[model samples]
Structures are given as C-alpha cells and as structure tokens.
Target: MLLSGELGPGDRLPTERELSTRFWMSRNCVREAVRTLSSMGVLESRVGAGTYVTDLQPQVLLDGSSFVLELLRHRNVWEVMETRRVLDALAASKAAGRITAEQLSELRELMATMDSALDLDERIAADLAFHRLIADAGGNQVLAAVLRTVAGGTTAARKRRGLTDAHAMERMHAEHLLIYRALERGDADLAATAAAAHVAGVEAWLLDTDDSPADQ
Candidate 1:
C-alpha cells in the first residue's frame, strides 16, 4: 500500500484481525508483519491507538544503518570507504555554497579541538565532528544521516591507520585545513576535490594494508 500510494504518512493501518481476514493470513502472521514494519520505521504503534504509517523520513529509515554497516564492514571495507568518499565530497561541495556563519564558527571550534586534543581518542572524536558538521551544513539531512553511518562504520579501521603512522594525524590535519579553506572561500569544486583527496588518502592506505587485522 505504501509503494502503491494507497497508504501514506499518518495513515492508520487496518487492525490485525481485519488485515488477516483480508489477506487470508493467520492473525499471528499479520501481527508479526506489523511488528517487523514497526521495527523498520515504516509503521508506528501508539499507546492508545493502532498502527499507522510513519513519516518515512530517510534519517528515520536509515537509523539502524550504522549497526548494519559495522557488522558488514569487515567483508566490504573497500566498498564502504568508496561510498563514504563520494558522499563526503558531495557534502563538502554543497556545504561550500550553503554554510552559515554559525556553522563556519562551529567548524573553526572543532578544528581547534583537534589541534589541542590530548590523545588519539580525543583527536579522532574531533575529526569525526568536523566532517559531521560539514555534512549538516550541506542542508541535506539524508546525506548527513548516510555519512553518519558510513563514516562511523569505518572509524575503527581509520583509527588503526592513524595509530600505525606517527605523522598521520599531522598530515590529516593539514588536509583538513585545505578542505576548510575551500569551504571558507565558498569554492564548491575545490571543496569537493579536497574532500575526496582527504578520504582517498585513507582509502589507499586501507587497501594496501587490508590483509592486516588492524586494517580490516
């Protein structure tokens, strides 16, 4: 019904008994189906009311993606990184044109956090925030939600790469400066190039060291 447009956001689903009778299925089966849809964010069950179709927002639908990606990342590390690079580039390009003064300030703060972070863990957290802020500033909630998942899934592997190289964080911070400068200048092409280049460095290193458990 949702795909066929017979049902939409805020539309209440038929009762399980009605659905079972209409579809010639057992009531238990109908109940199970509703439960599954609810878990996927396609349906909502109110306390005093019955099931209804949800708003179907992309962020809501993709909320569990981080967990799924974490489970599958080991087998598809390259694919995940590739997707992240493309998304990050898109986010940076869009943000270059749309970023607000407040967002720019926040990015500057995050950069400062990275610069003064006392340890690898603190630096990593700041690094993640910097990318996330750009994605949010892009004005595309769906893109930001997806990057949240893909970037989060690869965090450990990326951190491992950071751990192995003594100078990795310094080089990464420099790349980040280039990206931030492009965004500051409102240069979409430059922002995209810089974002892709930053991710590409990690991608190349990941591919070269994939056999290592640390890399995986």
Candidate 2:
C-alpha cells in the first residue's frame, strides 16, 4: 500500500480489527504487523487518535539498522566490515570531488586531534569524526544514513581490536593520511583506493585477532 500510494504520510491506518478481517488474519497478527512497521519508522501512533503512516524520512527509517547489525555481528562481522569498506570508499570518492573548503579544514583539524589524542577513546572519537565528515561531504543523505548505521554496527568489533595494537594504530594513521591527501588533491580514484585500503587493513587485523564477538 505504501509503495503503491495507497498509504502516505499522515494517512491514518485502518483499525486493527478492520485490517484483520480484510486480510483474513487474526487481530494478533495484524497487531504484530503494525508493531513491526512502527519499529521501522513507517508508522506512528498517537495516544488519543490512531496509527498513521509516517513521513518516511530516510534517517527515521534507518534508525534501527545499526541495532540490527549489532545483533547479528556475532555471525556476520566480516560481512558487515565488507559493507563498510565499500561504502567508505564510495563516500571518499564522491567527497574528493564535492568536499568544500570548510569540510577540508575540518578534516585537517580532526587529523590533528587524532594525532594528539591522549587516550584510546579520544583517538577513536576523532577517527569516527573524520569518516563521518567524509560521508557528509559526499552529498547523498540516504547513502550517508546507511553508512552511518553500518559504521555504528561495527563499533564494537573495532573497539575490541582495531585500535588496540600499537603497530596497527601506526599503520592506520598512515592510511588515514593517505586518504586525507587524496581528498585534498581532489583525486577521486586515489581517495577511493586509499579509503578501501584503510578499511581492508582493519579487516585484516580483526581477522588475525581471535576477535571473540561473543564478548562484544
């Protein structure tokens, strides 16, 4: 209904009993359907009124994606990393051509912050900010939203292993510098390559570690 235009933003949904009868489903099944859609941000419920279709914003719809990724990380950590690798590369490539002067300055500042960070957590925060700025510079809200969720989903795995080893941290900083230089030069291909390599390095380190996701 939503895809076909039968339902739209602010359109009130039929009562559960009505939907149950029309679809030949039990009321409990109808209720569950409504609940699932609500969680996906496709529907909104009011206290005195009833359920209605939501605005269908990308950010809202994708809000739960990170949680889903986190829940499945134990079995699909590698796949999650692979997805991030692809998205981060694409983001970097687009950002190379589209990034503004202000964004570039911000990236430079973030790099400095990472270099001077006194603690692991502070360094990690700077690292995340650098990637997020790249994503925002790409000029695609939907892509940014999805990439943000994928990044968040992998936070636990990264925290567990990616930044712990001194050698790995040094290598990652070098890779980050390469990515920044590529972006600074507006070289889309190099930016993509550098971003992909950085993420691949993280994957390599995680794979070599025992990386017991059960603990994550």
Candidate 3:
C-alpha cells in the first residue's frame, strides 16, 4: 500500500490502538507485521513521531536477496546457474529491443575495461558490472533485482570453487562482446542466443573443472 502510493512516505500510520480496533485484529498481529516490514526496510519507526513508510528504494528491498543467495550457495550450484542463464537470456532479448544507443556505448566501454582487467578481483567486478548493465538495459526493476542476487551468488560460488582463470576470463570477454554486438544491432534473437551460449559455456567449463581430479 505504501509503495503503491496508497500511503505516502512520512505519512504517519494510525495509532496501534486505533489500528487494532479499525482492522478488527489483535494488536500483537499488527505489531508483528509492522516489525517484519521494518526489517525489510519498507517501514521506519520514529521515536514518538510514529511509524511511516520508508523510501522503498530498490537497493533497500533487495538487500535480503544477497543474504538468501549466499545461504543457498553450496546446495545447488548448477540450479543457480541455470536460473541465472534463463534470467539473463530474457534480459538480453529485451535489451536488444529496448536499450538506447548510449547504453550500448556504455556496455562497449565496460567490455573494453574487462579486456585489460588482469586481477581476479577486477575481472569479477567487471564481469558483474557487465551483467548488471544488461539487466538495467532490460528496463525492469524486478528483473534487475533478481539478476543482482544471482550475480552475487555466482561471485560467492566462484570464490568457493577457486574457479577464476585466464582462460575463463578470456571466454567471458569474447562472449560478452558477442552479446553486446547483437544488442547493438538490435537483433533480439541473436542477443538471446549469445546470452544463452555464454552462460552455457560457463556452465560447461564449471562442470568440466568440477569433474577434474584437482577439484575433488
């Protein structure tokens, strides 16, 4: 209600007693609900001023997504990657149609930076940024939020697997370039194909490495 503009930020909520009576619910239930929303950054309680709607920024709402992804890291690596691939493929398809020329140029610049990023940490950061840019180009906040969570999870999983390598980085650069080119040309099919192929390449490499003796 608050986020949808039914209630505005800084607008004080009704008193607990009034809420309980009006809603015909126990005060305890309302209190718990408010507490949960507060924890999620959807509501704020001011000491005497009363509770009000929060700013409801994307970052605030999606903050718990990272933590959830982290907890699910080891349990289903392949599943996580599969989910990411699907999301990214959809994002790429949409971006091909929706992205602006300026956004395409920005992606080109990020790709260029990734080419020279020799350090593992730098490569990871650049890689995440590239994917995030694609999500942003899709022009959907919910999709972008989901992509951020998956990207963070992928980073965490890569650290645990010790999977960063020069070859992997090179492959990523090439794959990203292909996807960017497709989007630049405004070819939705090609963009989606490139995105899927890129993710599949990573999936194959990770699986091959996992089966290798050293991974055991």
The candidate that wins on lDDT is 1
Candidate 2 residue lDDT tens string, 94-188:
99999999999998898889788777778778888899999989999898888888888777766766456668577867999999899999999
| Span of ten consecutive residues with least summed lDDT in model 1 | 206-215
Q: Is candidate 1 or candidate 2 better by TM-score?
A: 1
Worst 10-residue lDDT window, candidate 2:
207-216
In model 2, the runs with Cα more than 4 Å from the true position are 10-30, 210-216
What is each predicted model's overall lDDT from 0 to 1?
Answer: 0.88, 0.86, 0.80
lDDT of 3 by residue, 81-146 (tens): 888889999999989989998888888888877787666677678778888988999888888888
Task: State, as a TM-score between 0 and 1, how close model 1 is to the true structure.
Answer: 0.88
List model 1 lDDT by residue over 34-83, tens digit each.
99999999999999898899999887899877788987787677788889
Model 3 C-alpha lDDT versus the unseen true structure: 0.80
Candidate 3 residue pairs in clash (backbone atoms < 3 Å): none
The candidate maximizing TM-score is 1
Superposition error at 161 for model 3 (Å): 7.2
State which candidate, 2 or 3, has the greater TM-score.
3
